[model samples]
Target chain A: MRKMEFAEAIESALKHAMTNDPDIFLMGEDVHTLRINLLAQFGKERVISTSISESAFLGAGVTAAMAGLRPIIEIMLIDFIGVAIDALLNHASKILTFSGGKWNVPLVVRTSCGGGYGDGGQHEQSLWGWLAHIPGLHVVVPSNPSDAGQLLLSAIESDHPVIYLEHKLLADYWLDYMGTGGRENVSFDVPEKGAIGEVPEKWESLPIGKANILREGDDITLISLGVSVHRCLEAANILSEDEISVEVLDLRWVSPLDKEAIITSVSKTKRVIVVDEDYMRFGLSGEIAAILAEENISPIQFGRVCTEHTIPFNRHLEDNVLPNVNRILALARKFKS
Target chain B: MTLMREKTILELYEAMYTSRYLEKIVTQLWEKGNIYGEMHLGIGEEAIIAGVLSHLIPGDAISTDHRSTPPFVMRGVDIESLLLEFLGHPKGLCSGLGGHMHLFCKELLLTSSGIVGSSGPSAVGFALATKYQKTKNIAVAFFGEGSMNQGMLLESLNLASSLNLPVLFICKDNNWAITTRSNEVTGGVLLDRVRGFGIEAREVDGSDCMAVWQAVETAIPRLRKRNPAPYFIQASCTHNEGHFLGDPLLRFHRSPKKELGAVTGPLTKSVLHYKGGRLDKRISSVSNVLALIAKARAQLSFSNDPIRRLEKTQTHLKDQFAQIKLKVEKKINSISERVLNLVQEEASL
Candidate 1:
């Protein structure tokens, strides 16, 4: 099987969905940068370029979904999604309940998130936690090219609005900066060179709210999503040198969280460390810790490794703020189980 | 404009009268505290609703704002269901989850939102679907001049025009955003601002039903043709009452009756002198006297309420308008009783 880049896999998945469903259409600013030229390939009617009006286009997507079309609206960056917060939070999330189930908004919003380059404040934040906090929305953060492809397929098929977040740093070009440049055990390779793994030849759809157990162990369960999942995997490898068997869990679906898998892992390991790129306060890390605490899992030792309260634009400052393998390993060592 | 039939003109009049009567009933019910929460009523803007909607077909979609009673009434939405919803009955629209502001009738392809400027983008979506499905249906978005400055509405204008969708953006200019005059808040000519997007934009006197009717009727053909584009209609009407039912009127130094009469005198005269069709005998009789006493009274007293004008106009038709109002009143009463039972049942639950 040949490896595929994360962005390429996303484009392939959208193309497959568009080929299969005549009702599917795409709208956003500069989707071509994401390697999507469905306007050229599938006709301009299927792939639409919208003005930088996030609220209107997002509302248009919700309306299109209500009118019986599956629309994929893209926000260039998750940070800019705040402009459409009213549409996303108030309209898309509540239309079904407010209408008494008269409407089903099968709209998918795809956008890039997380900071690696020094893109300053507006482009660097990973607010998937805030998105997950909103009920009635399916928040999916795919860590690898394969899951990115499959999860997008599932999101398009979902009966509700799905916010699909792709990490800007996880693309093939940025793998050079991720530790040691495609070297096994040292470098975190991207989709190329079989780092994230090969996408299936035929498009496959995954379940909306399931977690993947990357490495099974009993000492500690490391839970994370998106790019942090790779960091956890790297951390698990590092902890293996110390004879600390770490179980790495990739939470693909941040919302409708895979609580069963988390409980099963937390119960088996009896110690857990949740690693998240989002801000620690009022975010996914807290949610995970609260979930474990509420479940009353006996002899449990819980900790979290998340981004600092604020992220700065400076590259060194961003490195300190964002979670890394060293941070995950340090948290794991600090957990006194 | 093609000559509208005598029956069609009377039907339009009946629709306008129905909207006015419904708002008065809403005020009565609201004052008595039967309807919970706030209600935005278009007391003197009935002509805009009756005129534009007179051309609507079943498949066409319309999105409206909080001031949406007139459109729903024109669409023949169930009075019992609407009243029950306003009273928060479990059997109401949305099963009592959404109040009157969130009323949506799927069967009628009508959805009303409480948020201002929201209907513009939603109607664009509806129009996008119609164009994609290759249907003759068009989508109409009804909002006030107050919401015309909203970013989303302007964005929707650009989106609709760029996509060449079959959407009609109707801005019912009541000249007030609550107590603020629209001109004081809105800058430049609205028609020119909309035409900046290279889309067709026009204005009409909302007091004249025939003008509104003619404008919408003319736009329909262009919207249905090949490579159809979005159309904009700015119907200038009068805000006869305060923003909400409970809004203070003393601040404006005017009573509701005076404000209503200031607008209704010219509107009633226009409807009476309308030369499109054969008038009802009573309406013709009013036109004869309308010229002599048009300016004699600036305020309508309780006995000379504009709502009673419909009764006078329809006397030749066996008091049909009066009978319809009675039917609505009975239906409202029955719905209120059902709502009371629902409230008790829910409380027990």
Candidate 2:
């Protein structure tokens, strides 16, 4: 096992996957950041740096994947997905289904999401809920370094289109920038506990639809994913001090959604609090609540702590809008009471 | 002027005739209410499809717009499956889920979509795969001139040129986008627009299959090179059926006096309105409307039909033309009979 940062683990996964498969190629705008590492190692043929044309490049990646080549395309930011949604939503996601299962689009679209960087509205968005709502897409969001590396490999290997979202706060650049006395020496606060972990040296792909039980308890269950999962763990630890046990469930895959794990956890605790970084209305939290209601595993306490349906711009307002440890703890305490 | 072999010319003519006959049958079926939904037929674009696809081998890939039957038929996709798809059969291409607009043939490496300008990106992807595999196979995209204005298509042109991928973009400029004249919405010259991306651009008379064949034949060698670059061909053709089958413009042109009688009173009142503008300006506007209608009528002339043009050129081989027509017609008639029986079987079930 090797201890690596979130970014290093993702790079390790990509390097390993590309070295093993000759058909795998990476294309995106500004992917040349790995020029010395991936471009030099794989050559310009495999590591391509395209212009800022998302629809063209992403759609090209989709068709390339369909034509027997595995293409890993990076969309830079989730906010920019609107420009290329037709390729992902219309082509990549629906190609296999529309082709009567004759063609398979084994394409991976890696994009960064979440807010707190003060990068304005367009740059900061966690729209995984919107992506998961699409039928043929698999949405994977990993909180820790190990899961990030493993889930990405699984996504690359899957015979379907995968939307892999990385939280900007848990990214390597953010952590490295913060460590080096960030801009103006202002330390932007973010959850760092789940950013680094020990990844297995041997390449291993985690199943796409399984949730990890990060913390086991008999009290209320705290369900979340991506950066919010870290906050749930933090809240679980604080609640343990007050003799209140909280189970933290890290939902790794949002689309194939580990419903069995959710039902088991919610059934055991009989009280659940969903902490989501995405919007509150018609979002992940509502989907979870509906699942519970449909399963008739109700007559139990249920609560949610999610971001409002507003864009995050100002640093202070973003912090308030995004779910944090305080919000998880507040909801957990209310469920316990 | 590249001279094609007599055998090759016969093959191209046969393919074009087959497509024309098939689409004509499909139009009849649609008119008789056997086929549902809006049908976009490649009636006048057969010369372009046969000219480009005739040179393609099995491994070569093709991506096309909504009007894809001619290319699909010319590429050797199963005719029964295609006809069954038009009839909405479960065993049809794409299991009838994708109507005439969306068709897929895995063996031929062909795909079609109803979305506008999507063929460009799809062809780029196919060409990228060809480069990765280090093959001589090339990818082709067939779209209308209106699609040239789409951002994705322009972006695809830049990507293909920058990557030096083997992609041939064929723009069939039929002078119209549905009901609107393409020149009014499109800007500048299309050949110049494509040349701006540093790719070689050529134009050809789409009604002349020999001209289109020569253009593609010349481009194939450069595209099959080790370091291949993308190419563009702007083939100007006329859509005989306007945009789709039963287009109102075509209906208006069939009996101009009868169609105009219903609207002449209101049209004159609107054009000569006393409160709107000057009398001279209104009169000039009426003249412009009349000129557009006349142009539309002129485009539907039999001179633009590719089948007649090819037959006219092949007058010396009259016996060969007659033999080819009999074979194509016999094949199409059998296929049509089979499709009708299958529809009957399905209706009973």
Candidate 3:
């Protein structure tokens, strides 16, 4: 198995799609790093670096998509998405339906999200909930390198707009930098929990709206996504020593959510702990809680571990606000048989 | 001197006449309570629509702002469907989801947004696609002088320039943006500012259809070349009506009629007097100068009207222009009548 970083995997998926199709191009603000030498290789026409005007470029990306070109727009931070929300929410999301299915907005908006590494309130925020709320938008958050590569390909191939959120801390840059405390024994080249795998030579798109069961158990179901899924797995390992068997369900796609997996896992475990890195209110946590409540699933214990409503820039404060491994471990321990 | 071929000028006149007639009908509909919502009218600025659109061939795309009915009509968007859209019918372009403001016809490669400065970047995307696909199809982005100050529009200028995309940025400087004077709100010369981005820029009198056509004709060749760059044209025009229907106030800043009155003094004769000796030229006296001013203003307004702008120069083609106007007027009448019937049917149902 060949190891790959999370960002590398995403780049590989984009590079793979671009190599296969001449119509696909990348446009975004401050795309210098992700672009790397891709600009020199692909030429300026394809790997286009746009000015900081998000709405214009996003609108441009939408029009290009409508004109039979697949455009991937990179918003540096999910927080800055507010600037381009009009284009994303209005044009890209509804053009197909508005045009009576004549025009399909094949757009992929890749954005880095999450509150870690001291990027303040403006730079940090996992607003997948906001994107998920909008119809006609596919929200995908990959938990590991392999899924990141495959799911991005799916997003590119999607006939609708896909809001692909990448968590800051879970990316290979931070994983290689921070080493994730005590998980240092694990190989830093790939993610700690997931096995390292090579991207297929051809573009391989994973089915959207599917969940991955990273760790299987019958006692308690830990439902999470993105970076939170890795934290849940780490919590699962810590709870294993205490004889508390846990199931880790990674929700790969946020919208068209994997409700069947949630229902099946929660039915078997009879105890659930929903973990989300976004603000606890009106977000993924609330959505999961609503699903459980409506499903009439009989469980002895049900809890949710999520970040506090406020996201601070300070390292310690942001750490406390986010649902880290320690918080998930404590939450998982509370779910008794 | 003949500025263009009689057929070409007639085509431009027909497009302008269609726009003016349609806007007039829309204004009447809103007044009669048949149409709802904020409606922007392109009454006096039809020359820019005719001149710029005349340069576009089939396969070329255009993106426009809120005041976009002229382009929609000139681009040959189905009048029945567009009328239905205005009335919020299920079979409208956007299936009644978006009203007149969000008129988008993908088949014709035309898209509009109610938001200011929204269409500029979209035009860039269209240009980018044509360039990448080697389609040689140029895209035109039309916005008001007010939107020129918007950062997105400015960014679009830079993006189109650096990439050397085949795009034509047409800014209709109508002096008034809603109620504010564009000159007061906007800083720096519009042409100079765009030229700073290394884009070829031109400024022309928008009231003169011939001038606009000459400018667009000169600029379009560069855009059609193998390695084309973006072009910018700033057309000076007048917005004769309020920003929207029922806009209680009107700004007469730099009124075209007032200038025409100062230059022409009294209407000894008007071109509208041809065919029949109608509209007797009333001599002005010091006592009746205010009445003369009002009369002179009305005559000048009608004289400088886009349809009549070419009347003096193309006197030989007067009959041809009249025929074109009659045909357009007939089409607009038929379309509006059908729309009214549809609206009544919808109301009854």
DockQ scores for all the models shown?
A: 0.01, 0.01, 0.01
Each candidate: fraction of true contacts kept?
0.00, 0.00, 0.01
lDDT of candidate 2 over B192-227, digit per residue (tens)? 989999999999999999999999999998899999
Ranking by TM-score: 2, 1, 3
Docking class of 2: incorrect
Per-structure clash totals for the candidates: 0, 0, 0
Worst 10 residues of 1 chain B by lDDT: B291-300
Task: List the pairs of residues colliding in candidate 1.
Answer: none
Q: Which stretches of candidate 3 lie above 4 Å from their native place?
A: A173-203, B1-349
- Give the alpha carbon lDDT tens digit for every residue of B61-109 in model 3: 9998877789999888887777776665677666654556667787889
Task: Write down the RMSD of candidate 2 (Cα, Å).
Answer: 21.9
lDDT for B260 (candidate 3):
43
Off by over 4 Å in 2: A1-337, B255-290
TM-score, predicted candidate 2 vs. hidden true structure: 0.53
RMSD of 1: 23.4
Candidate 2 or 1, higher lDDT? 2
